[model samples]
Target: MDETTLKENKINQQASTTEHEEFHTQYTTLNLGPTHPATHGIFQNILTMDGEIIIDSEQTCGYIHRAFEKIAERRPFYQITTLTDRLNYCSSPINNMGWHMTVEKLIGVEIPKRAQYMRVIIMELARISDHIVCNTVIGVDTGALTGFTYLFQWREKIYDIFEHICGARLTTNIGRIGGLERDFSPEVYKRINAFLAEFPKAFTEFCTLLERNRIFFDRTAKTGPISAERALNYGFTGPNLRAAGVDYDVRVADPYSSYEDFEFQIPIGVSGDTYDRFMVRQEEMWQSLKIIRQALDNMPQGKHFADVPEFYLPPKEDVYHNMEALIWHFKIVMGESDVPKGEVYHAVEGANGELGFYLVSDGGRTPYKLHFRRPCFIFYQAYPEMIRGGMLSDAIVTLSSLNVIAGELDA
Candidate 1:
């Protein structure tokens, strides 16, 4: 009787265990990214999925981490602008300007009014280019490819403006510690004006295609919705935070780089969904256009750069002709230029959010320690939470809307 009872109990227990395993195995573990196209970056997400719905997600960064902060510590102040260029490669000028502004603050060099205005124009153009990429990508994620192709031409025109100014596109190391490396050339102004005249009409057409399109609205309107309180709690900023209905723009609140001189409205959204993010960025591009136009119209008549020979690089002609200018150029290039013993933090509204530079200098040629407050890195902390319980497609669209550039995120 004991042997029969024990055998029966063992059989029942094995069957129960097998059933449990089969039931649990129905929920698959899926790797959403690391090299996936929808990721839009080298970001990796390990998603726990029940069919197509994400039950949970885990994000892994640092895949493309070049140790930018550590690199900054080794590089001189002026040379570090190149590092900033790689931080947010989508809008490298903004990163360039932000780093330059931080160094300027440390050196106590007051930039000229014209230089400030020029910086504003470049930064706003960068902003517009960045938003164009983000919004168009959102459209593409939603299966609307027309807007992306249509607007990318304008983005190239903006890049042409950058190329005319700095002779570099994508990762443009455009500005200097005191101000821009040089003033905008006539060709630069011409390209900028042409872009300004053409982009608005094209952008309006792009908006008309998507803003009210039923498929786009259905895909984005309520998907990945986050409340204002939650977004602020997660340290969200830029269009993402503005999409959550918080109007905390660094330009308006902190007013750096003569932003106070410009008149522009901060566009805010209500639901903090993908659609809100897209719309907010669309509006931001318009506001950025307004700022750019004003900056160009009221550009002061003065030197292109501040008269800080110690910090600013001398003209190439001067460097070639004058021994003193050559010496200064060598000192500036070789990290021999003196930096003050102080700590300074400067933030600018980057295309993604507030790009901040925390510089600590012990009066050394190189920074004692440099820390970058990258907004993509900060906002990415909430990705798993944002995507949990959402469909995989929604996650893709939400990510596109967030515009989490890997350079910015991993740096």
Candidate 2:
């Protein structure tokens, strides 16, 4: 063929490609939510689409902003654990542990073996709960309300355990300065065992119901695939990063609270698509249950708290009977506890991702600066990239897939 013939063919191919754009010119764009049921929390996502296909997406934040960092800076070192609870409300226990561990590092305080084991057990349970909610919500967004009812029931059981341990359920500040507020009680033990015995069937039913459904697979399988490399560059961790085929779990890479002792697999995805994320999280729930069971069995017999009475508060009996104890309690509560002058970063395997506390102290009760390395913030950043070529409807599924809680993202 002549050069002019080749030029004409190239021009024709370009025209054909432009003519067949997934989002057609006639269709208009629609913004999904900074406040939609599918969005879980306060998060605004701007979606441009033609019919069902989404051409572009933009996620907006600052809706649930609490200025947690600024508040942390003003609070005492020990008091910051409460702030951590607000980071990922679904996984407050892990966030509480992360904040404590960072302060523990600065003070060179060693958490007891049982405390470490307990932290692992509780945090893993939170992880499983987090994944279950994300998956169930994704299912609900895709018109599978049955999945929501079944999974939410299981989630209620988990919350019941949390509420039993602490007075609150969702925002559980279960940790003390060096250990737990109290030891796991017999009642707490009984409820956990009862739930454990029954949870497997519910979990299996959840899988059998949705995992094999043709419509669910078709909606998710090849949609919103982000590459492992892109995921890393975007600074994603936890389940989101795992779905991208990078087996970089913080629990394994940087084990805190004796997580290295546990035996488990880090499930990785091949396509980094929505299907892989769903499967990866499902498998993780199984693994988390295993870890919880092991921790319960291997719980060491020792003190539930550390001997640092000055840093930690005195027991209730001592407070009532002893003048020294009363004086000490008054001092600690009044921001008179002298925290060491140092800066530390502690990262925990939160339900969402890496819930870290970057704290700087200046030998005072209050922190000089406090920064949180929120997982939802990083995971949600991949929104536009994941949905750039997918449909607008897929945004609902994709938002659930990312499992972003707006409180953490906005904070």
Candidate 3:
């Protein structure tokens, strides 16, 4: 090694020694993931525990690192949308929108009003699905698989809505930088409307079946509680942070894609514990329904893409007859269109927490850097804190309540 490399290594070693001296605690260490089924993805957590209470912890990752930023650097603007779907695959559309919106902002694309409303409707639908999966997993971890079944069935219906929209489910690359690939099919709308009508009955059944169970409450209530002050200090947001009694939501605090046009309530909890987090998601589902209803009520009439013929393709008829239209269509489809040079960070309300995309552009057809601010990643930081001093059972409830997805967390 060169002198510079040797010097850097020495500095790192000294830093490690200093940290160990200052932060040392008498506790046993445990490695919790990287293959654990309940980890949700490829994640490994190092825990520092003093018998039943945690003293400190460190989270180690990169087990499933595909170097997403490096991959995005090689893919075209449109191609990158598919990759974003895997970032937080449970709410793939939301991830898809965040990536596209940053690119759209860079290129100064003003999407049509119709497309904006469409994005809002589908995004809210995805949020509902994401939360249901998370909340149900909480039940499953706590030994209430019945709630998991009911909730999973409802989420399956939501996935059907996705399949109807784009002929694909899970990794739905349904949005674009300029606009959408197409409008929702009549059948898509009919199914969503039908699902909306039946949803209340299902939600009521979910509540009746799970929420009031004495055994369930005994497991969840007041167990593994974190103070509201500590949660804010930890950079938490979305339903998890809101459950700590701070009514901050990305959709309301920082509205995007016409979210401000819709009215909805933000749910909060007095105790920053597992049960409160569960309650927050359950109530937010109701608020999401309110958002969807309002967006549907005020749905408008207009073109899907704004009239950017170069970036947004013209109609097929125009493409066939007009030379300029043909050239532009070919350019966009071939990923040769010149997107602007800049960078922007955008986040939406994802199921687990704040799902953000920090994107950089080089005025080329492809992105320069793509980073996801995954909520599960930070929730893992509080793992030792959450399960410390609580029973081993509390560890299960705490993990489930955080709603960490290994795919998302590892991403």
Ranking under TM-score, best-scoring first?
Answer: 1, 2, 3
lDDT of 1 by residue, 288-367 (tens): 99999999899899988988888888999999999999999998888898888999999999998998988899998899
Give the candidate number with the greatest lDDT: 1
Model 1 Cα shift for residue 146 (angstroms) = 1.0
Candidate 2 Cα outliers beyond 4 Å, as residue runs: 1-27
What is the TM-score of candidate 3? 0.88
RMSD each, Å: 6.3, 6.7, 5.5
CA lDDT, every prediction?
A: 0.88, 0.82, 0.79
Tens-digit lDDT string for candidate 2 (183-226) = 88898899889878999999899999899999999999988888
Which pairs clash in model 3?
Answer: 34-43, 40-406, 41-406, 53-389, 54-388
**Pairs with backbone N, CA or C atoms under 3 Å apart (clashes), candidate 1:** none
Error of 1 at 348 (Å): 0.5
What TM-score does prediction 1 earn?
0.94
Candidate 2 local Cα displacement, residue 364, angstroms = 1.5
Clash counts for the predictions, in order: 0, 3, 5
